[model samples]
Target: MPDDRVEVEEEPVSETRLSLTADCGSCFGLCCVALPFTASADFAINKEAGKPCRNLREDFGCGIHTQLRQKGFNGCTVYDCFGAGQHLSQGTFGGTDWRREPKSAQQMFEVFPVMRQLHELLWYLNEALTLAPAKPVHADLRELLARTEALTGGSAEELARLDVPGHRQQVNLLLLRTSELVRAQVPGKKRNRRGADLIGAKLRKAELRGADLRGAYLIAADLTGADLRDADLIGADLRDAQLAGADLTGAFFLTQPQVNAAKGDPSTRLPGRLTRPAHW
Candidate 1:
């Protein structure tokens, strides 16, 4: 899959804090080459790892940067590397460009996925630390944050050999605690919607505030005008979900891919660090 440039907002993220955001200029198109994809509703063609996309430019920019969706490649618009690109292109490899140094290409490709997972964990840890009610686990969040951040600074070999899923399992425990602490503030018993198959379910104008929607298969579900504020959407399959006018303010762990897959409009509300998709 091809990669999109990072969306910037003055308050979305702070560069000095820890770059848990993409910096495409500092990357060598790793997301485009290091990842694999097959023909799907989201992608137009099949691409194998370590091979540059046909649309990749000499300077590593997407040739179809402004028209990815129209060209049948909405997957690129949805993908986020969480700043792993620059970390490998610069930090782990000493600012090396894979193009200039072809020998480093294989190693960089191999390590990119591991770095991406670590950076995603950092994204969750950073969000967990920001929640006020999660103070009970602040100390633990900090410890895990530091530990995950440290892993991001490791050498290429160290990153490739990392036990990423093991690290994620530990951090996920802390995040679950954070979710409980935050959702407890809402004035209702949380619903257990975890991994439920709600495909094409009519949920328009539903009162779902503070719902624990983690891992729900809500494909093409009608969520229009639903009160999804503070909803836990981690790992939710929202492909083609109707979110037109649905409130997602403070929705936790919602990724760009989810937003892109869903149907929405300008009236739809979003949390910080997320941009409205153009196709909407």
Candidate 2:
């Protein structure tokens, strides 16, 4: 899986703040091999899990990386491992490439998804700590972050048996609290659309400020020119959503993958942390 190929400044992440951005260079192309994808608008071919993508180079780089979208690999452009690939390749497996250590191939592949989930949790927790409104739960968030980070360092066998869903539930609580704290700062009535199926819904220029859009299916929704400031957009499905000129400034928990999937432009107001997709 190729990462969101957006050009931006790569900052040095602190020890406490894990790098949420995907670093494919330091990885062994685990996602390209471990994950399965069917032919669709996003992918051009069908590949089984644990099968290395034909486009994967011997050096673990994508053969057509620069032309991924052109070659019908749009899905690859939006997939982000949140730095899990490098961590698993170097940290968990001690820099042992699966191609060399054939015996550990299956374990490494199985552990990839688990580590990705843990890293995603760490990303959310780290962001929660930065919000001034979420200060009340900052300590609790840090504690959970430490615990989650510790889990990421677990051995392959330990990670394989981990209760990822249960762990996600625990992290979601703090993230929910953080969302409430942050959204409360916005004035007036806020919409509660959490987990709502608004696929392809026409929401052009809608007043969605401080809306609770967590886990909402907004796929291909027309959100052009909408006011989304301070919205809680965690886990929102934004694939092919029309976001041209929408205001997402200060939106909390809006990950890069979501932004990359949406159709945005120069006028789209994004939070500082995320970069504009190249194709947009």
Candidate 3:
């Protein structure tokens, strides 16, 4: 099937952290073929699990690269390969491009997603370690950060054989420790308010799974990877909220408009179709 996934413009290089700016030009589009997507609100059309997008050229660049969104493939716009795609295509695999060696294509593609996932965890874990107040856990943080970085540099064959979920669990443990170190200082007492004003709060990774957030002002909140499953978002204003990697799978009373008004990253899994929240 034609790669109908929407593509967003390349973000400003400076917008990404220095740690993430590893060379990716050497990669041969392994991510495009390795990851799978089906037609839904996020994707424009249905595609088989392993089939390459029709727009992918023999050179491994998108044929509609510059016009992805215009061509009705917005999903591509929000994707960030985290340098994993290219790293495996060129560095780990010694620039053995997938096209020439058709047999290696599947393995190369498979490793891309796995490496990308590991890179994503490293990104968040690194971010957590940077918080000033989490200084108490500095020693542990440094150890974990080094471990995560080492994992990123693992060989393609090693990465392809990695257990991503298990790695994620280890990283999650550190993140939880980081969160506790920070939140422990802040009073957990809930303030009295009928409809509290929480607009644009930095609630990233907060455990709000079953919290009563009804009719609350949540505009532009950074909800990256927050556990919102089964939470009450009824009448909650989600305009400009960042739902990157957030889980709203079973969130209650989350109307389409509420989701439509917010900004969502590709990792943001919502209950239903609605283009990523508009205020990206």
Candidate 4:
């Protein structure tokens, strides 16, 4: 018989900064309105940009928050704006709601995506500074963080007109160097699967430690019990991947969206900033 011990519910170990995570209570339903989705394997229904989801409540909460997946809204769970929702709600917009100020709606919606990108970079740069092996690039990381943070705090017009891709390229260079320095410590042939299309491939229990899977398409792939320790997962597509018991310690740029999309067990060890999803 099982132990029958009452297991304490631990808050999922989150690897992201609090400011970078969605604060639904603080946000004003910007994500529900500003962004759009399409009917696909990822999203349940089609939604055009600049239009609010039909399920958005007057209080800016999802009507199906609890039954999102069961109600054919699984895609809602995978979408993450990297805390840009609250940042635009309370920070950039100064707590002024777009619904009340209809004129600001277009600008706020446009700038939200830009802010999301900026915050995402901030997350990466901030994580880069935490790696002891990446200490050599700490100064550069700080500079990049400062620049990205400034962009997040910019006015809607400034954010809408920002050269975000250019800035991201600069940050990516630093992240690439950081990946090299950190992966060197892990012994084995370092696998470079960057931007490779491996959709639905079977990779169960694979020796993937220190592998570079940046931008790789692992959609719905079986990665059960895989050893992803010290792997570079930056921009990797983990949507619907099976990560039950997979070790993702020190995985770079492994955001909540990717994690939420994947399946994992409570025993699965995560990086410092990653949060274990509840559906595991």
lDDT scores of the candidates, listed in order: 0.83, 0.89, 0.63, 0.81
lDDT tens readout by residue for model 1, 1-280 = 2111121221343312468779999898998888887888778999998989888899989999898888888888878888889888888888878889999999999999999998888888777666667888989988888898888888888888899989999998889888787777767667779889999999999887778888899999999999998778888998889999999887777887789888999989888668798889
The lowest-lDDT stretch of 10 consecutive residues in candidate 3 is 3-12
* Model 1 quality (TM-score): 0.92
Work out the TM-score per prediction: 0.92, 0.94, 0.61, 0.91
lDDT of prediction 2: 0.89
lDDT (Cα, tens digit) per residue for candidate 3, span 222-262: 98898775454655787668888998764543554577567
Candidate 2 residues lying further than 4 Å off, grouped into runs, are 1-17
Candidate 1: residue pairs that collide: none
Top candidate on TM-score is: 2
Model 4 weakest lDDT span, ten residues long:
1-10
